[model samples]
Target: MRADRLVSLVLLLRRHGRMTADRLARELEVSTSTVLRDIEALSTAGVPVYAERGRHGGYALLPGFRTELTGLNHDETLALLSAGPGRGERAFGLGPALASALRKVVDALPDAHLATASDASRRLLVEPETDLLSRWPVTEDVPATTMAEVRSAVLTGRRLRLLYAATGETARWRTVDPVGVVTVRDRAYLLALRSGADRTYRMSRVLAAESLPDPAERPDEVDLDRLWRDRCARFLADGHLTVLVRVDPTRRDDLLNTAVAVRTEQPGPDGWPRLELTYQDAWHAEWALWQLGPHAEALSPPSLRTALHTRATTLANRYG
Candidate 1:
């Protein structure tokens, strides 16, 4: 733990150029005395760190000094480089920080693996800017001042006063306890509680927000992953169609990935997998099955099979 702290301390100085002992302590979540001891440890371990004394002075790394940290294996190097194109940066308000961090990740790789990794990463696209049928990602205008308040309230366990619009409702001011922020498919949601009931508000829907001075009346800890999953299940259950089908095993992953909700799956006697799924509508079920080509077959709720048949007939006639 101390070794990690020492390394982190060095990196902090490296990234920021210099930091005062108190600032380092706050960042590292340690005592100022502990920070001083870590600096001594780093210096003793042959790191080129030094302190300057003055009202405007702090600790800094020597010129051109850097800790050697090229430990990524070939696959790991490529994996690290496989990042999406700045959608997260826009959603989380990270802006240019993601770009800067990615640059550092690539530059930190060993010399021999660097070229190979960079070359391989180029051939892979996480989310390309455009394709033949490109839908440009629209940037949502989540006001910086409002987001700042929401983030602070969530992080500090404080309540927030929000001028929010619920589906078709007018924007109204109400105090709510902050839970956490969730980003799904580039859209941000603020998960919080109002009147002790869980509520989810889209960031785009929040007209304005302010951090309340009072501490939020909520649990000390929340299982956000579990909570999000439960919410998603409940959401899909509302006005969503359920379809049972049989899919080839090889295409199982593709089906699961593309489906709105994979309710259940089981091995079938015919060597395929039986899948129960939920989708927004009959049209959605039709489109998803179409993507799987002949690998998937709709088995129930005859309307879905009808939709597929109609689509296939349309395609056949078009080609005819």
Candidate 2:
């Protein structure tokens, strides 16, 4: 961690030239003492750095001393400079590191293209910090300590004792073999084996966690994407309740996109589209179709129709 901070410090100086210890500390989110120690470390490591004493003096590196890093082609340089203020980096606690890396990308560019590239990048916008019309973004919360412990367990191939709070169930501890951690749509999940069965646990629902001593018996090599796909396929296949439905022609894509699957499609007598679909259960079918409202109608399996009608009546009565 100190090494990483040291590298970031060097990159900062390389990018922005001489900066006060106070400024560096603020940029790196550390104390002035830490920045001083890092500067001493860099000097000890043979970095050509020096201190200046004056009313407007601070730390500076030897002119032209740059960290030899990845050389970006023209397009890559533009892409790096045009990237969003990454909210995803906050999810993994890499926000500062990402910023440092982006700085390095700019610092590493050839001088001939530097000004023009930097100027052109300013023309592009990707989710600016504030806009007059846009709402502020809210990311999901997972306690930092809990996420760090979970991250350590998954990275080290260790088992975890999870105090997970399942829906409507009392908080209970389970020992799970860590397979991987995934952040989907800003929500983090742990894909693991609990009692030799695949399970997915939302990181937010984990009340507490502790790493186990024993190494998890995870495969030496894993393709996490493939494993996730297999898990998803099995989950969908297990959702056995099938229904026949008719949807307005214009909303066919909307229905298909929102619904889990459309197993079959045809045209009905009125020339609207008809579809056969599957769902996890009756509640799943009822709720999913109910959200579509009048655009789609559950045609058959009589039970689904009755369930929808009952729900509509209940809503009407409540509103009345």
Best by TM-score: 2
lDDT for each residue of candidate 2 in 133-167, tens digit (9 for 90 to 100) = 36454457888788889989999999899999998
Clashing pairs for predicted structure model 1, backbone only? none
* Tens-digit per-residue lDDT, 84-200, candidate 1: 343566665565667787788877876778888888888887756654446465546687778878988999999999998888788899999989998886678898999999888
List candidate 1 stretches off by more than 4 Å: 1-86, 100-124, 130-145, 247-259, 266-273, 281-297, 302-320
What 10-residue stretch in candidate 1 is worst by lDDT? 130-139
TM accuracy, model 2? 0.60
lDDT of 1 at 237: 88
Q: Which ten residues in a row have the lowest lDDT in candidate 2?
A: 130-139
Clashes found in each candidate (C-alpha, N, C closer than 3 A): 0, 0
